[model samples]
Target: MPVKYNVTERKNLQDPQAAPKFYASAKADGEVNLKSLSKEIAGGSTTVSDTDVLAVLNDLIKVVSRHLADGKIVKLGDFGNFQVSISSDGAETAAKVTSSLIRNNKINFRPGADLRDMLSTLKYEKYSR
Candidate 1:
């Protein structure tokens, strides 16, 4: 199936006098949850149950979360890499920094080679509202 995108006009908030620019935004056809994904993977093998796939997937999530919390970069082979990132206010001096200076924390995912190549291989279709 071809991925769908729509042309959107976005204004530059930083420059009010600038002309609006056009960009291609992906038009989502639908959302697939973990249950649906497990079912799809199980379809190829008649012996594997969806429940088994789901159980393994659940364990994967837990393992990833635990390792990431421990400040370890989790690499899922060709799938991707997951790590933690933090944003904090700058300190006047190295000794002045404290826990209160820390502002935000987030998990960052970097796609592996196979996932990154999908952008060039996938077909696209223009979507109109």
Candidate 2:
């Protein structure tokens, strides 16, 4: 199946006076939450129940969160890697920068081989709203 995309109008932020430009952005058909995702996983395994999958996924999230907070990168094999990213204020010198200079932290996910391959071969179709 082809991926769905919607046309979007964007501006050049630096040159606000420039004419608007149109681009194609991928649009999700729908989203699956933990419960729905777990059911799908269970469907692929005869021995695993949806409840079992959900429990394991919940624990995985907790463990991953703890590892990230401890400054560790969590790698889920071919699933991807997750790490904490920080945006900080600049300091005149390296010595002048401290934890106080840190602005905010965000989780960054770098997709693994499977997702990269999917992206490489994806076909797109313009979505009609």
Candidate 3:
């Protein structure tokens, strides 16, 4: 399926007084929750049930969270790698830098080869209400 997008008008934040520029923004066609996603996975295999997929996925989330808290990068073979990233306030000296200065901590994901390939080959379509 092609990705759907809609036209939008955007103003440059740095120059708000400038004329608005037109752009294409991706619009979500829909969202799939765990149960729905599990069912889809189950359909691709004969041995797996939706419930089993859901249980494993739930456990995956917990396991990933635990590993991340331990300062480890979690790499899912063909999916992606997740790691914690942070920005911090400038420190006057190396010795003065500490965790307290850390801000805007976030998890960052770098797409794996399979995902990168899929993204590279994606097709798009303009969406209308």
Give per-residue CA lDDT, model 2, range 1-33, as digits (tens).
898999999999999999999999999988789
TM-score winner, 2 or 3: 2
Candidate 1 per-residue C-alpha lDDT over 36-79 given as tens digits, one digit per residue, 9 for 90 to 100: 99999999889999999999999999999999999999999999
The TM-score leader among the candidates is: 2
Give the per-residue lDDT digits (tens) of candidate 3, residues 1-129: 999999999999999899999999999999889999999999999999999999999999999999998999999998999999899998989999998999878999999999999999999999978
Ranked by TM-score, the better of candidates 1 and 3 is 3
TM-score of each: 0.90, 0.93, 0.92
TM-score of the candidate numbered 2? 0.93
Q: Whole-model lDDT, candidate 2?
A: 0.96
Query: lDDT rank, highest first?
Result: 2, 3, 1
**In model 2, how large is the Cα lDDT of residue 96?**
98
Separately for all candidates shown, the number of backbone clashes (residues 3 or more apart, or on different chains) is 0, 0, 0
TM for candidate 1 is 0.90
Cα error, candidate 2, residue 68 (Å)? 0.3
Off by over 4 Å in 2: none
Q: What local lDDT does model 1 show for residue 90?
A: 97
Task: Judging by lDDT against the true structure, name the best candidate.
Answer: 2
Stretches of model 1 off by over 4 angstroms after superposition = none
Give Cα distance to truth, residue 90, candidate 2, Å: 0.5
